[model samples]
Target: MDEINSSKQVSVRDFTTNAVQVLDPGQDVMQWTFGGLSRDSGHFRDADLAKILRNVTAAPASAFKACRTPEVLRIIEILSIEQGQKWGVCTLNEFCKFICLKPYATFWDWNEDEEIAAAAKALYHDIDNLELHVGLQAEQAKTLWPGTGLCLGFTISRAILSDAVALTRGDHFLTVDYTHMQLLSILS
Candidate 1:
């Protein structure tokens, strides 16, 4: 921290101690790192850190081009409606569409007894095809974090948002979730 303060080459944000505490609960040691301080310290007074945060927070809509195909949009609409109703939202038609849709579409026969059963089969087929095309992206990821290996199966689907955020270099990777934040800090 003293070296960073002395060099003064990179603009640093000053996060309040309170904010830092809130953002990093278990891994408070991260506050000592340059990136962590910039995010947790109430020091947005620094021009450079402010600019970095702004760039990070902006949505990457262009990346969603692949997610908006007609088939994906339809599925997203269905999922969004179901999710919206559960959340007590009045009009989730549009928002649900956005959340459920993806750039890639996988087709499957829907003759199964249950809609979920049919959807799972379709999703499995799509994943198998995707695995062939991408050559085990999760396997590649295991090389990066070898200790526990890459999360797979059901957990992989739940991690889509985090995976997307991880791809963004400009994002502030801060959070109270120690495990995720720790991984982000290392990856960043």
Candidate 2:
């Protein structure tokens, strides 16, 4: 941190001591790092999973850079305390609600139990379908998006954990406890 402060090129707009927000202070916090796990890992926005599936999985690593953009920054910013309060995050519940109402929705249209049950059967086989898969249960999904706070449904951290579990069950996944947003991406 002192080195960061000393660097002429470094921005001094903010500083921290032990993650407690000593400079430009607001919340009490600490930092954590997830690294050096055996299994492969990558960080991504919910919106960017499609891009990753298309580019990184389907094409090549060189094709990956095209999908990284400010839009991702904006979406992730919704999870940070600094910006989340100002620009509310998109709730998965709200997104689902929109799906139920929107005439252009590519997924299930009806809200009734029978229709939802039928849709569930269809989605069960193709669980990777983004339009249908939100990792939260019904009650949790209804929880108001804690704007300027963490997403009420599945968090980015949990998503990473889920990815690790999916790839190699019981494999260790590292993550930090701090609420301040951080980015972790695996290029490969």
Candidate 3:
């Protein structure tokens, strides 16, 4: 932290710490790295998972410039917080409601694990203010059923499932590119 702070570069960590209004000055709050899909969760108005992480992931290692893995992860978390602050994007419950799923009623509902829920509560103060990325990642992953593909957190699975359904239902391959067998072959 001191090294990054000493350099001329703007400290994104400091920005995030301030932007999110860290609930505890003594505790380090990287709110989005909750062991779920945080690495994949920066999707919002000005920031996206790929846009936010591609450069960091592609950065030169032991070369001209490099970022620590934790630093990169923190940047993703920071982007989510900044996006929420700028755009007033929906919180986790609101997002679930938008997507036709039940909103998590409490922090415990968000993550069954006692410790994780406690940590999230400490940082966010309430479920109503929980950032989309943070709450989405904090949710405990649902058990994968037989023959089902994803083992994602409950919210992530539902969000992804809805998106995938929309994409497949509106696919150009089944509409714009539709074709029939040649006339000669059909006759034969």
lDDT of each: 0.38, 0.35, 0.66
The regions of model 3 sitting more than 4 angstroms off are 1-10, 13-71, 144-150, 176-188
RMSD of each: 21.6, 22.3, 13.8
Rank by lDDT (best first): 3, 1, 2
Better structure of 2 and 3 per lDDT: 3
Residue-level error in angstroms, candidate 3, position 114: 1.3
TM-score of 1: 0.20
Worst-scoring 10-residue span by lDDT in model 1? 132-141
Candidate 2, residue 42: the lDDT equals 39
User: Which residue pairs in candidate 2 have backbone atoms (N, alpha carbon, C) closer than 3 angstroms, thus clashing?
Assistant: 84-148, 85-148
Best by lDDT: 3
| Candidate 1 Cα errors over 4 Å, as ranges | 1-34, 38-42, 54-85, 91-188
Estimate, for each residue in 97-130, the C-alpha lDDT of model 2 and write its tens digit.
4444222122232222354435544754332232
TM-score for each model:
0.20, 0.17, 0.55
Error of 3 at 168 (Å): 1.5
Cα lDDT of model 3 by residue, 1-188, tens digit: 44466333546767556555635556555444432335334433335445657766785432111122244455665666788779987898889889888888888888777888888888889888788866766577666579864456777878888999899779877545543455446567
